[model samples]
Structure formats: C-alpha cells, structure tokens
Target: MMYKNSILLGTIGGYRDRFHQFQKDRSLEERLEIAKTIPRTHGVEPVYPQDLGADGSGAAAVKASGLAVSAVNVNIKTEPKFRDGSFTSTDAGLRAETVQYIKTAMDLAADLGTDMITVCPLIDGWDYAFQADHQKQWGWTIEAFAAATAHRSDVKVSIEYKAYESRNHIVMPTMAKTLHLCDRVGAPNLGVTMDVGHALIAGECPAAELAIAHDAGRLFYVHFNDNDRGADWDMLPASVHLWQTLETLHYMRRIGYDGWVAYDVFTRTGDNVEAIASTFEIMEDLEKILDKLGQDTIESIIASGMPQQGYRDLVKGLL
Candidate 1:
C-alpha cells in the first residue's frame, strides 16, 4: 500500500522544560543526543523555533547540535513590542522586520533540508473590537508571506487556523475559511495547514474537511492533536474523535496526501518525557487501526448506505 513519506511527529512547544529538568544544564548537543533516542514511526523529528534567553540557544542550538531539523514554525503574533493598532498600519519598520524574519526562516529550512514551514496568525487576549483589525492584520501578513516566499519554490508555507484560544477568535478559523485565504494569497507555495484538534474544537468533522480540502487541492500540511467538544485547545490525543482520526488517516491515504503529520501540543501539565512517548505510541496505534480497516472495506461500507454509526462500528470491528 502506498503512503505518505512517513508521518513525522515532533514536539513544537513543550521540550524546554524537559531539556532543563532531565539534562541538568547539559549543552544542547547532549540534549539532542537524548532527543535522537526517542522512538518514532517516522525517522524525522523537527523542532519549532522559539527564543531561548539571551544565549540564543533554542532551535538554532538544537540544529547546530547535528540532529536533523526538517521544519521550522514561526509564530508571528508572539513577537515582542511591534504594536500596530491595525493590520493596515504597514509600518515600514514592522514590514521590514517581518520580511527579514521570514527570509531567515526560509534560508534556515533550506539549510536543514526541510520542505515546509508553518505560520500561525494567532493574537492573544484581544477584545471584540480587535476582530476586524486582526483580520486585516492576517490579510497583511498573508500578503507579506507571499511576497517573501515568491522566489523560494523549494519551501512551502502553511497557514494554520485556530478557533478562539490564542485570540478572542481567528478570522480564518475553519478549513473552508483557510482555503479562501489561500486563494486570496494565490501563491503557488501557499496552502492550508489542517490541525485535527482545531477542527474538532470548531464542531467540524476533520475527516470530512480533509476530503473537502483534498478535493479542492488545498490541503498541504497537517497537525495531529485532540480536544473534546467542550474542552479548550490541546486537550489530548484522540480525546474526542478517535473514529474521526482514523477516517482522516484513511482519507489521506485514499487521496495520496504525501506531507508531514506533525504533533502540535503542550507538555507542561506533567512529565513531558512520558507524555511525548505515550503520544507517539497512541499515534502508532491509530495508524495500525487505519491499516487494519483496509480501504476497500471502508469504501464499501460507505457505498452500502450504512449510517455513520455503522461506519464507526465497521472500523471498530477491524480494530
């Protein structure tokens, strides 16, 4: 059976504490030696870039330590002290900074042999009045990204959508909305980065959306996390939609989606090491569940006029 290049899952935001607690002031080289030992279904593990104090010892340090870094995620909203009241502010200084940052990341990805980078337009703790302004800011950000990546066809840009956590809300907070933004950006390198957890939180079936995006030719990247209907973001793995996740993987296989499936979660609540290991185990189990289902059986059930509940039962039987 054909599959995407292997599904590469890695920690984006939660390894800092793990490094400090377990490494005991060891250098990043030592920390990466530990990261390399974690068992993964996919051979590649990419770390997200964030500031690491005055020493500049975060992702850059990790990359310098010789562990393979395949992707880098830039959180634009988290930058310090670039306060612009509106997206249209177009402060020459801010634009310059944003452009330079993007270029630097693109260069870093090329250097590391990474194929994609994700940009999240998340704003924190804003009021209703900021919604329109925030949307405009996202538009501007998209334009800036398009301009920055116009010449770099080797690297792809994924725009991730979230519903009401980082900001009071997000403008393009759904797969459909994200597709529209991608159309507006209209760059060859621009595409939607689908996060399964965000889709579940928005009360949408991720499997259905994956099919829709695949049909529309807009699905480029994926993030795997889970949340219950009533819960906030980053709840846990398959907490609300185990069946949906299975269906999602199956659909990706059906549509021949060959892209990265990175894990986007926080490990602050407990032992980060165990949490990461357990999450990988769960993901592997999910994949096995999909494998046992077999594409022909799944397609036959849907064609047989069975209800969605029956579909779930069919998958469970395979499991």
Candidate 2:
C-alpha cells in the first residue's frame, strides 16, 4: 500500500451540502458527480448507513459512480440525545445504541469494498468541570470502541480526535491521547485519523505526530485542511499553516503513508469547485518543491539529530 504521489485524494459530500445549504439538499449521486469534476480526485466519502439506503440502493448509486469509497464516517454527534455524550453517556441504552450503530457501519463498509470505518466520538466530553465523571466515561468509551472493532478484524476503525467541538474539551483530544485510547482498546484494527488542523490546535507539530502514529502502526487515514492554529476552521489545504502543512506532507512521503489523503475543506463562502481545484493546485506545487528537495536529502536531514540546524541550513541552501 505505497501511496506516494498517487495518494487517493477524496472529499466529503457534507461540505458540499453545507456550502449549498441555501439552495437545496443535494443527493449522494449529485455530490459524487460534482466531485468527479475535480481533477485528481478518485473518491467521495459519503456519510454511512444514513446515506446507504435500506434496500442498499444508496450504496449501489455510489458504486455506479465508479468512484472509490474512501471510508464510511459514522456520525454520532448531532442528535439531541447526544447533547451530553454518546458512547460515554450515563444512559446504558444510549451507549448500546452507539455501539450497535458502529457495528452496522463496519458491516456496511465491508460490503462497500472499503476496509476502513472512521468513528469520531465528538460528543463524548464535557463543557464544564465535574459535569461528567472522567474515569467512568473513559472506561465506557474504550469498551464501546473495543466492542465495535471486535466485530470485524478486517475493517480498520480510525478515531478522529479534536481538542474541542460540541464541548470545551473533547475526550480524545490529541494524537498522543488518541493513541493511548487505541492502546487501551487493545484492538489491532483501531487507529487514528491525523487531521492536521486538529493537530495544530492541539499544539502539536503535525509532522512529528504523523511520524509517531506511523511508528505505532496506527496511522489509518489523513484529513487535509488548514486553520489559524486557533480553531478547526477547515479552510483550504495549506491556506494558513503553509510550512507546517508542507512538513506534514513531507513526512507523509517519508513514512510512505499509503492511505486516502482527504481534502476535508469547508468552503462556506467560496466556490466549492474552485476551492477543491485550488487545494489540488497548492498540493501539486508543494509536492514539486518536495520533489526538488528529494527523499535522500530529507532522510539526511532527519538523520542529523540537530533538527534546528538542519532546517536552518536547508532553508539557507534553498535560498
């Protein structure tokens, strides 16, 4: 699975829907057709089970599009019942429902010929101190994930983490923290979705974190976007954090991360197609610069333990 320059780029239909919210709800096929217009994009990541019709027609529509299914993102955060939490909720019934939903998603993903399922328990956290029992909630969350993945070892379950969304503090908030949860779950299929913007907000160097996840054998997928290091703005790729995003992509090359490099952007006020094209254009430019740098030179820089001097010299040499 050597992704290299041929990284299977993808994007979300939800972003398209949100961008066209003032218009009308676009069907999965319509969104898939829109994505097909973008160059270099080979897939469309549709929301799971919800998008998959009861008669399997929705999955059939996606398959007919001839676009690959990147991964099925099981949404668990929007309902009123999940206002407090979902997997870690005190209500046993709600916990059971969440686990069951994940299992169904895994089965559907397998059916769709995709070997991955992305589960982000975004609602499993608190906005205030003492609002929820931390220790107990952690236990439930781990158990729920373990149960979900235990159903099928063939399908990988990647948990996307964020510092805060739907709450002041999210449970799996950082790369290290999410990796710790993966360890506790003790499931071989469990991994992390290295969303770069979230990593930046978590105060982590995205390249280093990518290396950590790859070394741990837990880097499943990557969500590409940019932000001002203050929020998960989901802006276009390499928009604000130019150097950091470049370093992150360089490390992706370094580790041979052969996974779907998704263009998870939010273009609320911009032309969706142009935004997607611009992202690809920027990626192409940055990748060309990286190609000029060459893998051997990058390896040499990493080999030198003094990263500060290596980076300084590399920049000066480029100039």
Candidate 3:
C-alpha cells in the first residue's frame, strides 16, 4: 500500500462519550512516547493550541520523540468565545481571529515540514431553521477560508465535514459541500479531509465519496474510523462496516490516493496502545485481502453490475 498512517492525538489522549470517559488523562509527552512505539506509522496528528506548543517548546518535544508530523488538526471550536461559531461567527472580530489562527497553524505546518492541516468547524452551524441567514454565513465562511488559504500556496487546508453533534445542521456537512467551499474559495490548496465515520453518519457510501473527491482533485486527506451506520462512534476501522472498509480501500487505490489515513479511533475503555497497533493490523488484513483478490478482479465484478456473485467472490476471498 502506498498509503501512510498517522495516529490521531485524541486516540491516545483519552476517549469519552455520553456514558463513558477515559480512565486516565495522559500528558502530550506520554502520548507521543506511546506513538513512537507504534510500528509502520508515519507520525502523529496533533491538534493546534491544545496539543501544540505555541511557544516552540512543543515542537522540540515532538522532534525529540523521533516521530514526524502527519498534519496539524486546527481547532477553532473549543474556546468559549467560539461557542456560537468560528468562521461563521456574527462578530467580525471573532471571524478575523479565526482566520489568523488558521493562518498561523498553516505556517506551523510548513515549519514542521508537513503541508496539511485539518479543520472541523463543528461550531459553525445552526441548531434550528431561521436562526441565522444561511447566505450571509456561507459568504462569511468562504471569505474567511479564502484569506487563510491565500496565506500560502504549499500548505493544504482541508475541511472535515460532519453531519451533526455540536449543532443540528453544520455549515459544511458533506463531501460535496466541502468541495463547494474549495470551489468558492478558488484556492488550489483547499480540499476535503474525508472522515469515513462522518460519511457513515451522513448516510453516504465511503467508496463513492472517495471517487467524487478524487475526481475533484481535492481529496487532500483521509481519516479512518467506523460506526454503526448511525452515530459518529469513531470506533476501530472495519469493526462494524467490513465491506465499507474494503470498498473504501479499493477505491483509494483506484483513485491513486497516497495521503495519510489517520487512525481516528476512540479507545473508550480499550487499551490505547492496543487500539493504535490493531488499527494498522486491521488495515494490513484488509489491504492484503484486497491485493489477493486483485483490484482488477473486483472492478470486473462491479463493472458487470451483478451483485450476488460479486459479493460472494468478495466474501469467499476472506475465507
């Protein structure tokens, strides 16, 4: 596989949900140390401001850990000031601060020898209809993103769209909508960071999303996780959607995607180290099976438009 892997910082930090929370809260140094032990991984994906050290000491810590940076996850939602929204905030000052923060993150990414940053604007959405003017918010967001991306040509700034959670309906909530931002901003470096779990939450097929993004030349990055077809569980890859995982990997190869596949799993109560290692282990299993079956063979089945035997062949390959 040409694809490299990165451990999402949240995976090692600690996981929590409505019913459960992480047993222990480990420091960033401890998490990175654990990250260095995971084999075949390219690096760690840390969030800005929270996981990053703005004073330069944090970068030194990362360098000492002997792991490279896959990408900087820019967080614009946690601050109380951004509770209403970041990019789409009604306050012009807040919006401008958000843009400058993202720009700084891009500069940090370049300084760290990486060219990618993932932004999940969870707070930039409305909970109900007629709460805000959609047109105005959209324009504000596009202009904010345009300024951020225009800061540099080499750094790739991507939007990771989610269906719901922080709000009822998010501004950028799908691959197509994310592509819309890329189109509206008209920046070559702006793209989509397609999170498979989020795709499932939005009731979309991962393979199809990859094909669309690939066609757009905006498939900047990928985040790998699974869910039960409803919530954004962020469970281990292939834990619930076996075929979805296989199909997604197949399409990635078909689309010539060589970017990082982030292990965005939430260990909840499981061992963190085990979660990291097993994510790669599962990918190895699926990737090998795909190779054994052959991409051309699988494509032949899909091209024929015959479902029964095609699926049978896929399942039989596993046995």
How do the predictions measure up, each by TM-score?
0.80, 0.90, 0.97
Q: Give the TM-score comparing model 2 with the true structure, all chains together.
A: 0.90
**Candidate 2 residue-wise lDDT, 24-67, digit = tens:** 34567677777777777766666655677533568888778787
Model 1: clashing residue pairs? none
Once model 3 is optimally superposed onto the true structure by TM-score, how far is the C-alpha of residue 178 displaced, in angstroms? 1.0
In order, candidate lDDTs are: 0.63, 0.79, 0.87
For candidate 3, the TM-score is 0.97
Q: After superposition, which runs of candidate 3 have C-alpha atoms over 4 Å from their true positions?
A: 18-20, 54-56
Give model 1's TM-score versus the native structure: 0.80
Query: Against the hidden true structure, what lDDT does model 1 obtain?
Result: 0.63
Query: How would you encode candidate 1's per-residue C-alpha lDDT over 1-319 as one tens digit per residue?
Result: 2332222333423334424532123444454555566667343444334432222346565556555554566545654643432122357567666666566666666766677777666652254773455565666766676776684888877767777655566656788877876777787777777888888878888888888888777677777778776645464568667778877888887888766676665555565545556767787777777667766777888787888876686857764
- What is residue 53's positional error in candidate 2, in angstroms? 4.5
